[model samples]
Target: MIIEELRDLIERHVRPDMSTPVEGVMIARDEVSTLEASMSGTVMALVAQGRKRLALGDRVYEYGPGQYLVSSLDLPVTGQFLDAGPDRPALGFGMLLDPAAIAELLLQGGAAAMPDGRGTPPSGIMVSEAPVQLLDAVLRLLRLFDRPRDLAMLAPLIKREILWWLIVGEQGATVRQLGLAGSNLSRIAQAVRWIREHYAKTFHVEDVADICGMSPSAFYRNFQAATAMSPIQFQKQMRLQEARLLLAASPNDVAGVGYRVGYDSPSQFSREYRRQFGTSPSQDALQLRGGELSLAAGLA
Candidate 1:
């Protein structure tokens, strides 16, 4: 019954952009779609219907109804709905992970709630089947959409309960890292932020490592472990994704868009963009303009 109601809630709330009246929550219904490239963030996602698959670096993850996925940090990912269209669109829910709320729960829960020593930080993304309690909490949270007055009053409480379920669930170790100050994941998060802000500029790994309070070697290894891509590779992905976003708005200026996103050579930019998206910049732009491709909604 939880799955059925959950699907009904998501279907009723689904929007073209998947935005919901509830902040930090999303409901998506798709009539199938092509593989899409995008960035993921710290968030938890659950499916009530159909199946979805995402690729991050060399790793691939797939989850279907009654399953959930969590990303502990922001990372590059490509994903798609594997089934469902028109007669039975895919249905899903997403909630952005809030470190502050997780930290508060950790404080109340104390050491018993924390995962063991950092060791090698867990991978940035993980998938698990949704337990009943977690699904129930999500269902209750969605019910507030029709109860606007109670929504502002009770939504946060339900959201925290959903997060608590995640913290203590199978991927507890991965979820805990998001709230642990100075954690390896947190440190890598700093490095991720630095690179994202300065993605277009050149910076040595050592300098960025120092910024994250990590040695160059440790930073490189952990960054690779958490993000599944080398620092250089991460920057390149950012450049390509940004170029695509710019292209959506200004499809005519392929060279200018490429250069602005930090490519020095239009030919190289075109080459890499094609390698990444399987289409030339001009063609992808055309597809994007024609509404064949969209970057607006991913697991993040």
Candidate 2:
């Protein structure tokens, strides 16, 4: 029932660009089944209606109403609404997770929130059930969209409440490390950003590891654990994703697009593109030109 209400509210306020009057909050509506390619910034994506199926590396995650997904790292992501359509489109609520805010909560809560027994490194992304309290907080937050005058004064409080819930929820550890400075995930987060920035350039793992305050061996292990992809594989995904976006815009210049994204050999670019997207660059470009676009979750 709460989700039904959430769905109605989202449908009413959802925009073509998936933005809202409230900063950091977005509503997503999708009517297609096509998989989309994009970067997953640190975000909280809660499904109010329908389902979202996302793929990262070899891992596939699918969640529906009353569930939510969070990613603490900026990683290459590809996914779609498996059950969306024109009549009953998929709807979702998304918000960026501000590290400073989480850090504040961690500082306020002290030790319980900052446990020393962090076991296996958490993946950059995680999904879990939404408790009623979290959902209610979000409900109240969205309700403020209609009260623009009260928004600036009250939005931060409710958003903080939502973060509080997430900090204490099932995926708490992941969110907690997102705020900590020296945590393995935080270090890897630095590396993820660096990789994204220089995705096309040749670089050594040791150099990146050095930048993250990690040794090459430790950094490689943590990076793989968190992203489910080796550094090279992650970079390749970025390259292909950039190329796909380029192809969508300039359908006729496949070779040039490849070269622009840092591929030296046109043949290698075509081979990898087909392997990544299951189609040659020119063919995918034609479809993109013919009104086909992967709607990678509206908020992405």
Candidate 3:
């Protein structure tokens, strides 16, 4: 079976850090993991063994063997390994999705066309069953490790093949829009980028809408649909995540970290921090330093 072959290849080639010879590929092997925040970018995560759950805003997604997850935009997400153990660890492969590569394939135009949505909006994240062809392409990509001579020439080609499969799969609409120049997804992505860059500063919706080339109302609707959160909520997530990173490095300067991240009142900052992370900022820092919490908790 393709799943069995993929499991074997991943287990053999995957190092403890999940790095591989392939440039944009990584393998994950975890015996156990807790729900932790991490930044998920444009990538496809295919699980060959065990199960995992991911939370984006209020939405929760769970997948297991023969399944895959696609995050079309960069966002803060909480992930947990649901079923893993020392004897049977959670194993998965992550392949970064390149919009440029997808654009090139779109120009060539030989594969299945994307389904029409008739103005329906698409979300940034999706989960679906991994098709046999996709699994086969992943297997071939991993197999390149066995032939160092063929890797340089073949890796990019296989990577494109894998993306092509995704472009025609159930989540094609989301993947397809990533390459379109003025797509709704692209516009929302622009707004998302602006918010991330200027998260600490307060901005009005009209200004952000102008940046995205949309009216206030339309931008709000589409942005909420794409990201599962309002623009202000998105900014809050970014701010909180950045504060967590700052606290990780300067564990003792809780008030300074909060103020630096735009929190004016120390009490308010502590209150919101506890709400977002389920613990006080000071305590979270201690746990992080003691190695009890995942470093990913600081990522956005």
Candidate 4:
């Protein structure tokens, strides 16, 4: 019943406008055809009327109405909306997480007790059942869209409330570490940010590990634990993903696209690209041009 009510409210409020800050837009009417992965920004997503599936490395997750997904670090992720219909297309809201908001909430809620025993590393991403209060808070936030005048005055309060709920809710520990200054997860997240910003530039693992404040061995272990991919593998994914975008953008040289993304040898680039994407860049680009590539692979 709550889900149904929430669904209706979402359908009404989540308009097709793409002008919202933090990529908060309603994607209800169209069926997404591609399975694409982007540099996973830290964010929160709640589906009020549909199910969505996401793949991170070898692990996959699905969440539907009454559930929420949080990404604490930026990593590569393959995502698609899995279930929605014309009667009720997928209705959802996403807010890119602001680390400052997390930190501010931690400072405000400090009673000096670690309520969630959140001392260890947490998965980079997590999903948990939505608490009623949290869901209600979000409903009020969406209602603000109906009154643009009120949004300026009331939106911050509601946004803070959402962050607070996440800090104290079932997955609080994970959210908590997200803001902790020197937590392991946060450190690794720093390295992740560096890689995303400079994926096309060559960098040594030692330098990255140092930046994350971990020894090389420790950094590698934790990075793999969190992402299930080696640092090189993660960087490779970023490069290949970028290359695919470039290929799709125009009739460019495949070898040039590879080299532009830091690949030194065209032969090596073609081999790796084929291995990761299951088709040669030349062939995939051809399929993409002919409209024969599946929506999922096209997204990749």
Candidate 5:
């Protein structure tokens, strides 16, 4: 009953017309959306109705109403809604978590409440029930849209409160690490940032390790723990996903696209691309251009 009410309220305020360029209002709708393989940011997603599934590396995660999911670091992922229909669709709200904000909040709150010991990597993903208090806070935050002036004045305060709640709540320990400087999660986050910024360039594990302030062995172990993929595997994902986007946006030379994404040997690129995407780059691009491929199936 609560979930149904929440769905109605969300659908009322966060309609398609309210979409934003950066951060859109969250809502529930009945549509079979395509699965996207892209870099996921640190986000908090709560499901008020229906269900959703996401695949990260080899790990798969699913959650439904009253449950929430968290991604503490960026990673390539395949995500789709499993339960959305005209009668009862998947309803959810997601807030992007900013590490700088979280760090500042931790400093303001003092060191007393911060967890002790080094931060470890979570399994790249985690899910838990959304406590009533957290849900209540979320509802109140959404209501702030009606008070446009107050949104500018009090939205930051409320957003900080929500982050604080996440820092101290169950799995709060993992979220808290996002703010720490030298933790494993922080290091992996550094690597993730670098990968996102320079996805078009070719880089080695040692270089990424140096960027993260970890030795190759330690970085590889920790990165795998956090992302469930080796550093090379991660880069391959970025390259392929970006190539897909480039192909979809325009008719470009397949070999040129591969070169742009940092593949030196076009033959090697074609081989790996085919292995990952199940088609040669040219064929894939043609299929996408012809609208013969559904994103969900292509991603699968």
Candidate 6:
């Protein structure tokens, strides 16, 4: 079975560091891990074994073998392996999405491959079934790890093929917009970047709207539609995620960490942190220190 072969290849090659000789490619494995909150960037994740769940805003997405998840924009997300064990670990492959590569393919294929005007607006994150062609491309990409001599010459070509398959898949419209400079997704991505860079500061909606060249109402609607969170909510997520990172490093200075991340009151920070992570900051940090939590859980 292709799934079995893929899982075997991953088990053989996946490093504890989650890196491969192929740049921007990684494999993940976990045995009954806990749910973790973190931020995800633009990437596609294909599950080869077991099941995983991700929570984004109010949406919950679950996928197992033969399915994939695509996060087209950066957003805070809660994710975990739903089912796994030492005997049947949750395994997955992930690759960073490159807009430049997608744009190159779009140019070679011409405008006909672009999304039509009637196409639906793209969301920030999406999940779709993995088609046979996509699975084949992914398998070939992983196989390159075994052929060091061919990796240099063939890896780029195979990666391009994988992106092409994604662009033509069921959620192709969303993937297509990712490469178009003037598309709504691209414009919203600019706004997302701004909010991320200035997460610690408060800003007016009109200001961010102007940055994206949209009216405040339109920006708010599109932002929510794309990210499933309001601007304030998005900022709060960033702040909280950053705070968690800080707390992991300096577990004793909870109040200082809260103030540094833009919270005015320690009680308010503790309350929101608990709301977002299901535990107080100090307790979460202690878990992190004790190895009960995995820092890599937040990363790809």
> CA lDDT of each candidate?
0.88, 0.87, 0.84, 0.74, 0.75, 0.85
- Alpha carbon lDDT of residue 42, candidate 1? 79
Residue 279, model 6: lDDT of 91
Which digits, one per residue and each the tens of the lDDT, describe model 4 over residues 62-119? Answer: 8888898888787788877776557657766666677778888888888267643224
TM-score of model 5 relative to the true fold?
0.87
Against the true structure, what is each candidate's TM-score? 0.95, 0.96, 0.95, 0.87, 0.87, 0.96
Alpha carbon deviation, residue 22, candidate 4 (Å): 8.2
RMSD of each: 1.5, 1.5, 2.1, 3.2, 3.3, 1.6
Better of 4 and 6 by lDDT: 6
Worst 10-residue lDDT window for candidate 1 reads 111-120
Show pairs that collide, candidate 2.
none
Output the worst ten-in-a-row residue range by lDDT, candidate 6.
113-122
Which residue pairs come into collision in candidate 6? none
- Candidate 5, residues 1-300, lDDT tens digits: the string is 566667776787765543422242344454565555666567887887777888888899888888888788867888877867767666777777787887888788874566742745777678888887778777777767667777767667777777888887887777878887767898888898798779878788899999888889989998998898988888889898888878876646887888888898999989988887788888888989998755431111
Q: Count clashes in each candidate, considering only residues at least 3 apart in sequence or on different chains.
A: 0, 0, 0, 0, 0, 0
What lDDT is obtained when candidate 4 is compared to the true structure?
0.74
Give a tens-digit lDDT track for model 3, residues 1-300: 889988998889989777789888888778876778777877899999988888888999898998998888888788888878999988899988887888788768743365433343587888999988999999999988999999999998999999899988898888888777667888888898899899989899999999988889999999889889999988888888899888888899999999888889999989999998899999999987787877562111
lDDT of 5 at 97: 79
**Which predicted model would earn the best lDDT?**
1
Model 5 poorest 10 in a row by lDDT? 17-26
| Candidate 1 lDDT by residue in tens digits, 13-106 | 7887778887889888887667888888778999999898888888899999999999998887988888868988888899999888888888
Pitting candidate 3 against candidate 5, the one with the higher TM-score is 3
